[model samples]
Target: MKIVELSMVLKIIPKVLQIFLNFCLVLLSLILSFLLIKELTMFLKIFMTDGSSDYKMFIANILIFFLYFEFITMIVKYFKEEYHFPLRYFIYIGITAMIRLIIVEHDHPIDTLIYSLVILILIIGYFIMNITPLERPNRQK
Candidate 1:
């Protein structure tokens, strides 16, 4: 039998690059989130009066929250070995996003219903994937 030397193991550069990219991307997203929140808060000040449609500001807050939450999830998942996506969180984001899209788009009701159906299918897919059972524990075949 031939022996495999530990020193002969080749380094994987692409994974290293991917790690670096995920880190930088997260930082960029966080910075952008902060800047957007600052700008939106300032912009909403004009609508402080009664009878103003604060819906824009409310939707903005929901979007900003989801953006930052996704950034935080990415940061946490960067070091995890297993698949790192939080399925429920993504589904929740998708639902909120579709709602926001409907609110902002004013599209035909039929189109909006179709879009919502797509989002529902996506959430169901995620749930199915998350609930799938593992075949084995602690041993590789």
Candidate 2:
């Protein structure tokens, strides 16, 4: 009957979507790996260059390198943890990004203050998350 066929199609859709998502994630990991390599080379180049190199630019690039590294690590963690992303990695990324933003765009005092506050909030949140138990007793079987 058409109902049976429709039910079969519905069941297949989720599997197909999961496969597509996995493929996209793999492709993204590859791209991020290339970008991390490029960032490393650029960092080395900036480090080796003469005094003409901008210090702010150098710091910014280093932050960017770490950012790429963190993302790649997160992706690896994703596969290792059965496709689930831990909130800690996201917090780490947010903290790193906020620091990078502060360093690269401190031209405005107010904006810099706001960014600093945001970083503080993230750190506090991370601290709270750290202290919490991984599993609740009620959730346990």
Candidate 3:
């Protein structure tokens, strides 16, 4: 009886921890989203005030916003998929981040080439993940 009780307690512990972690994740996501919005507003205000014609800065800011958007989506997906993170979202984030890096700092040819290669690898991984089939457990007869 003691062993059974201990086992039950152990199982309950994990569930409790998972719930707590999920709550924290939600709170963090909300905070990050608010921060992103504030940054975006600041960017827009700067652009409006300066009346500058620098398309690069505008594009970079847009890409950064997409990164934040993807992160939030990833968090939402974690809850929707029972705490499992889908690989595609991570790949998407990686690709976006690399592109942003290239756009913001592509002065060196070798560095640009390496970043491009990284983006290529991430694209290949995304393709493979999409093509792979998920295995379902077989029902016992």
* TM-score, per-candidate, Cα-based: 0.63, 0.90, 0.88
Clashes of each: 0, 0, 0
lDDT of 1 by residue, 36-108 (tens): 6775666566457667677766666667566566655654664473536655666666776776676666558
For candidate 1, what is the total of clashing residue pairs?
A: 0
- In order of lDDT, best first, we have 3, 2, 1
| Cα RMSD, each candidate | 4.5, 2.2, 2.3
* Candidate 2 residue lDDT tens string, 20-104: 9889988998999999899889888888888855988888888898888888888889889988898989998899999999999
The alpha-carbon lDDT assigned to residue 132 of candidate 2 equals 91
- Stretches of model 2 off by over 4 angstroms after superposition: 136-141
Residue 133 CA displacement from its true place in model 1, Å: 1.3
In the range 28-94, model 3's lDDT, one tens digit per residue, is 8998799789879968776887668877888888898899899999999999999999888999999
Q: Which has the higher lDDT value, candidate number 1 or candidate number 3?
A: 3
Q: Count residue pairs with overlapping backbones in model 2.
A: 0
Superpose all Cα atoms of candidate 1 onto the true structure and report the RMSD in Å to 1 decimal.
4.5
Instruction: Tell me which residue pairs clash in candidate 1.
Output: none
Q: What's the CA error at residue 135 for candidate 1, in Å?
A: 4.9
